[model samples]
Structures are given as structure tokens and as C-alpha cells.
Target: MAKQVAENIQTVLRRLQEGDLLPVYLLTGEENYYIDVLSDFFENKVVDEVSRSFDQTVLYGRDVNMDSVVGMAKRYPVLGPRQLVLVKEAQDIRDWEPLMSYLDKPAPTTVLVFCYRHKKMDKRTRLFQQLKKTGEVFDYQRIYESQLPQWITDYVESSGYTILPGCALLLAESLGNNLSLIANELSKIFAVLGEKGAVTASVVERVTGISKEYNVFELQTAIGRRDVVKCNRIVNYFAANPKSNPIQMVLPTLYSYLVRLMIYIQLPDKSDAATALGVNPFFIKEYANAAGNFTLGKLASCIGYLNEADLRSKGIRNAGTVTDGEILKELVFKIIH
Candidate 1:
């Protein structure tokens, strides 16, 4: 009775953008990114701005009772063909049985939309079951970190930007789970790059302006060289920007770097290390200097530290109550010592 598939929120919104009207719409979720957008679409599309003053009514669940909502739904539009009755924060209202009775015989001429933000309707409740059966219900769930890369690619392609898989993943790693911010940033890149232009890693680093000198790249370099001081400095900067540099982004990047170090640690000493690693010649010297400083065990420990750092960022168990800056400081100390 519930729409439970966790996919792009855009799929439901696209249907609404196509302009077909549903008699009842229920949008309930903790993730408001999609809910808010879809609600606005219905409100604007169903009523004219001028006529909305008289015909379209938006009610808060806490302020008014269910009787008031039923009255609004039963009322005819003033000179308009249809009416919009929107209930925001519908999760706050109690005794929804009366509302369910009205919904059983809801007016054909009235469009009712419920914005239940940051919570779910009780599945055991009859009103919830009836609403699910009769109306279009949208559940906005957060996408997982693993799938974010491909999602970013699809999002960019839809906006007319061609991005390589690695580039897409890099942006996804840098931005984390904030789709709205990712979309906003992608729009800026599209405007600057134009069609037929591919988004590259360098371009991403440039536009994102993630501090090229002492950033993840530099941190990796420091870790590879076993320079604890340099690693600490770069990591402190990273901590300072945790909102932008979420642990979701940091863990994967650090993992990838340490894994590469593990591989390099196993290889025999070679004059042409770049050719051995299949990397650009420019990176050969960097890896060459770093190869001797790391061991397989040490690299494994670094990976463990990255995982712990990630958990700390997420506020999981064993996570010390440290600010983002403190977390970075501790990570650097662990890696360095």
C-alpha cells in the first residue's frame, strides 16, 4: 500500500511537471529536497497566482482543526475551475479519522496536497492506508553513498553536461549527500563549460576551488612520504571545511589512495615506477619517493583510521565527541604517529 522503492525523487516530480492533476497527493518524508519542490510545482501549476489569493488555501496542521480542512475542501473555487487545499506539517495534526472520512468522498473539483515533512505517517493508521490506496503518495528517501557517483552522472547529463565516470564520482565524493547543492553547483559548471564540453577532474577541482596546494592530493602525498607534519596540516584544513568536505567524500578518497600505496608497497624496486603503476609520468616520481615509506600493514592501519574518521563524522558508537576540527587533528596524529 506504500510506495517503498528508493530511487530518484525526480521521477515523481517529472510526472507532475508533465501537468496531469491527481485528486489527492501525499508527500511525506525526512528528505524535504524533493517534497518541497514537488509541492511548489502542484501549487503553482494548479492555480493562477492572482486567483490563488481567493481560491487556493494553505493550512498548517497545528493551527487549524480537521473540520476546517474539510470545510475548505467542500467549498467551491471562487470563479476558478478548481481549488487547491494544501496542508503543511500534516504530521502535527491528531484525530485524522475525520480527515479520512472526508477523503473517502473527496471533492472532484478540489486538489488536496499534504506536506508531511521529516516524518512518516503511521502505517497502522487507517487514514494512512486509505490515503495510500486512493491518492498519489511520494516517499523521499536519501540515496546511498555507493550509488551517488552514477546518480551524479545522470544528473549532470540531464542538465546537458558530459562528465566522465571518474569525474562524476569525484564530484559525488567531494559534495557528499547534498543533492540540492550538487545540482546548484552543476548548473554553474554547465553555464561555464557549455555543451559538448566534458567535465574533467582538473576542472572540478578548479571550479570547486578545493585548495589545490594543501588538500586531499597533498594529504595523500604526505601520507605516502610518511611526513606526519604535512599530513596534519592538510587534514586540519580539510576539517575546517567538513560541511563541504563530508566524511563520505573523505573516506573513499583516502581508501583509494591507501589501496594504491598497498599495491605499490608490494611491487619490486623499479627505475620506471610510473610505467609500473600505469600512471602519468609526472606522478611516477611522487609515487617513487613515497613507495619506500609505507608498508602493507601501515597502509591497512591508515584505511582503518579513515573508516574510524568516517564513523566519527556520522556520530556513530566509539566516536569521540569532537568537533570537525578536532576529528581531523586526531586523525592526523594517528596517521603520523
Candidate 2:
């Protein structure tokens, strides 16, 4: 069942190239990046270039109704054995019943693809159930923060490059979980570094224009060690570059770090600490150090400080003239002290 859903674009394209085409595909998800990739592949790859001129049809949900889609799907190919009917923005289609009925007896020679972006189809619905029975349904879920480091490593390796230890985590911290943005940044880095070199932390910082010395990851480490001077320097850098290091983003990450530290302290089995905290084993030492530095009571108070700092960053209950830099300085001071 996992293999059937086609998690990666390469799998779907490989199947298509092998002539293992399905009659219908319902590609729906919050992640539009994968949906766009698969939908574009079907548009351009499913048929030969010459045959596509006559056999391919692209329809949008806003511009056409379900009847038009069914009508398109039932048409015979002009120059080949197969035809491609692709519907983009499928979530906008209000009437799915006609499409569901069409899926029940879809044309044998036509390949129907639906690109539903920004949301998923309800699994309990009859339409989704019918799709499962008759065609392919790929659900593209957003990558979680904990999964980003490994994902980055895999993506870099797949692109024929290797990333040094901590490079992936640095990129994940700086870029967050936006896959498309990260991919684009990686493309630039690869283009500059060429194919053979290892992507070190320095390489990532240089190529992506994110700071290696003053990033949130380093700041988190500094706070864990109770190094007030290091924290002050990093926060000062952040204060100088407010656009690069917004208080809103920093506060949440810091808050999350403290919360995870609190959890690490409470767990009975130290062996399972990394798994429970959803962090890599390599970084377990940092959490261990943080747990030692902060008692459970102090950890709770730090979390409260972060909560209040978060509110102030958003201009909620914030007094006049407190800049983001000042708030960050104060927050770091409180945490370090």
C-alpha cells in the first residue's frame, strides 16, 4: 500500500516510462510542490511531443465544469494509442459526483490526472474510496522539522553530492520546512560548488547567504552551555539583522528547545531521550547539557518567558518603542541568567 501511493516523483516517472500508466490519478495534498511536479510530468511526458499536440488536453477547475472534464477524458487520441487529460486546481471543482461517476468507467485509452493542491480529499468519502479501487492516489504531506535534516541529506545525495555532518541541520534551521525554497537554494549551491565537492557548513553558509556563526542552532548551543557572552554576541548579530533573524521565528525555536529540554529531564530512560524528543542522536548531547544546566522549575519559567516574548514580538501587550533586537536581548538575558 505504501508503494502504491507513489511518494516520490522518480517512482511515478519511472512507472510512466515503463508504460505502467494508470487510467486515473487523484494527486491531492497540502504540498503543492509535489503535485505541480507530477502534474507537469504527466502533461509533458505521458505522450510523444508530436502526438501531444492533438492528444493532450489541459483543463482548470475554475474554467471548466466536471462535465467538460468527463467529456475530455472520453475522447480518442488523434495520433497515438493513448491520450492525456489533466485537470489542475481540482480542489476548486465544486461538483465531484460527475468526476466520480466517470472514474467508475473511465476510457481505456485516456490517462486522466487531477492536480488537487493545498488540501486533501476526505478518505471517508466515496469518491476517494472509488479512486483507491480504480486508480492511483498520491497524498503529499509536508515534511516535519525533525525530518528536514535527513530529507536534506537524501536530497543532496540524490543530486550527486554529499553534505558534511551538521550541514543539513544548519540548512534545516535556516530554511525551515519549505521544500521548494530549500530545493531552489540547493540548486544554486550545487551550481556554484559543482558536482563533486562535499557541502560543508561553510559551503552552505556561503552559498545560501545564511550565517554559520550566529544562527539559531549556534545560539541554542550557547544557551545550553549557559555561555552568556556567546549568547549576547549572537543576539547582537540578530539584532543588527532584524530581517534575517526575526524575533517571532527565534522565540518559537528557543521555546521549542526549552520544551524539549524539559521533556528530556522528565523521561525515565535516558536511552530513549532522543527518540522521545524527536531529535537526532548526534545532538542528544546538547539536550543532555541543557537538561543539566536548567532544573525542571527553571525550564518552566524559561518557557513562560518565551511565551511572553512571543506575544511581545507580535505587538501584543508590548509597550511602545521596544524593538525586536531589544526584546531578543532581554529574552536571551533572561534565559542565560
Candidate 3:
């Protein structure tokens, strides 16, 4: 499903570039990245700059109804081969039934685009089926977190930059699977690199201010090694900059790490540990090395501590006010002790 959504981007872009356009482009999806990409093209590239002033119309869903949208889309271009009626936030337009009539016989000389972002149109509805007959419909779901690293790597290379091997994974770790946020961060990296250069951890750290020594992954490593000093150092970094490393993000990561460690310990064979853990094989050694530090019982205890810390962070049954730093410090002490 994700792959199909990705393929929709280039196909639609190619059609636009070649001046082969459909009447209605229904870009509805959970992932707004591709929707915005196509929407931007329509707004900037579809009509010539001179013609756009006369022919192109941009509408927000909140400001217009489906009748208004259909009315604009029905207009013929005054100065170009095609007119553009772009509707941003089409998801917010509740009068969808009014546009169904327009979809049956849309204006041939107008490219009507709906950026129905962050929500999908009901595929079972007649409106969706009618859209397929009248124009292109792209429903892009968000990509998985596991797929983000390769996506980042591909995006950088496509933009004429080289990204180091684990650097993509590191970026994925720090940024999660939010493509827009990742893209924004990559832009910062690109600005520093000029035309093109290799993206390394140092470069990422330098541009994004997400330290190589003080992210959630590093905190996991510190905890795995039972290095109390290193663990506290990382935690302090997170505490000082809580926005970058929120307690919500930290608790889940630690809990997942401990769960994976417990799973690694019980695996009879070590060769398939990476597959089992849903992690890259190169980092399996971290789990292997940490196996000696945590028995099954200890792993359980650490997870319990993580759960307790999570509750405390939420202010559930807590005796007094405790800072995120204090809760994390207390959790680490319990884990490594």
C-alpha cells in the first residue's frame, strides 16, 4: 500500500510535466507530503506565470463549499491551455456530495486539484469511484518506521547528496517516521553543505543540534553497558533540552529496548536475533553484549522501573513534584543497581 502511494507521486508529476492532465485530481491521504508536493506543482508549474494571474485560482476548503469549488473548476482558462482550481484542505469541505455531479462530466480544459490531506476519502463511496473515472486519485498512507531509513537515504541521493550508511538510521532514530519533519531537518543539512556533500553523523549533529552523544539511542547504549556515569550524562542532556528529548519519547524507547533485550536473551540461536528484534544486524552486538549485564529477572525489573517512571511522568499516584530529570535519574538507578 505504501509503495503504491509512492508510485502515485511520479506518475502524476510526469503527467503534469508533459501537459497531460486530468479534470479532477483527488489527493487524499494520511500522509500530506505527497499531497503537498503535487499541490505545489499545480500552484507553481501547471499554468505559465503570466497565465496564472488570469486563470489559476487557489481556494481553501474552510472558505468555500463544494458548489464553489465546482463552479471555479468549471471555468475555462482565459489565457492558457488549462485553468487550475486548487483546493487545499479539501478534507475539511463537508459538502462532498455537491461535487459528485461535477465529477461525472468535468471541464476538459481545467485541472481541478483537491489536496484532501491527513484523511482519506471513503473508498467504498460512490464519490471515490466516480473520481477514478473522471481523474486521478492518490491515497497515500504513512510509511512505516522501519522503512524510513532507506527513504531518507533515497531522498538525499535523489537530491544529489551522499548519506553515510548508519547515518540514515541515526536520522530515522532521531526524527522517527515523520517525512516532513525529516525533510525539514535535511534542508538544514543541505543549506550547510551547499550544492552537495556527504551527510555524516557529525554533519547531522552540527546542523540539527541533536547530539550524537545524547540521543535516545545513546541513552539506550549507556544503559545497556550499565555505565551509570554515561547514562546520567545522556539523561542530563535530555533533561536540559526536554523539547528535543521528551519524557514521553524516552520512556517508550527504554521500555522497547529492555523488551528487545529480554527477547534476545531467550532466543536459543543468536544468528536470527536481528530479525527477531526487528532491528539491523549490525546493532545486534549491542544486545549481545548487554545480555551479560541483564538477567531475565533484571530485565523484568528494569521494564517495571520504566513503567513506574512513565506513571510518575504522568503525575499518577506520585507523592510530590518530581522533575523529568529526577524521575529518569531514579529510574536509571533502579535499572542498573
Question: How would you encode candidate 1's per-residue C-alpha lDDT over 163-221 as one tens digit per residue?
Answer: 77656655665666777787777777776786757777767767776554555656677
Compose the digit string of candidate 3's lDDT tens values, residues 74-117. 88899989899999988889879988888888899998988987
TM, every model = 0.69, 0.92, 0.91
Quantify all predictions' global Cα lDDT against the true fold.
Answer: 0.72, 0.85, 0.84
Pairs with backbone N, CA or C atoms under 3 Å apart (clashes), candidate 1: none
Tens digits of per-residue lDDT for model 2 on 1-337? 1122223666777787788988999888777767877887888889999998899998888998888899999999999999999998888999888887887788999999988888778999998999888899988877677778777777788778998647788898888878888889999989988857788878778888888898998999999999988999999999999999888778878887888899899899999887898877888988887778999998888888888888888888787689989988998898889
Residue 145 C-alpha lDDT in model 1: 54
TM-score of 3: 0.91
Best by TM-score: 2
lDDT of 2: 0.85
Error of 2 at 189 (Å): 1.8
Per-residue lDDT of 272 in model 1:
61
Residue 265, model 3, lDDT: 96
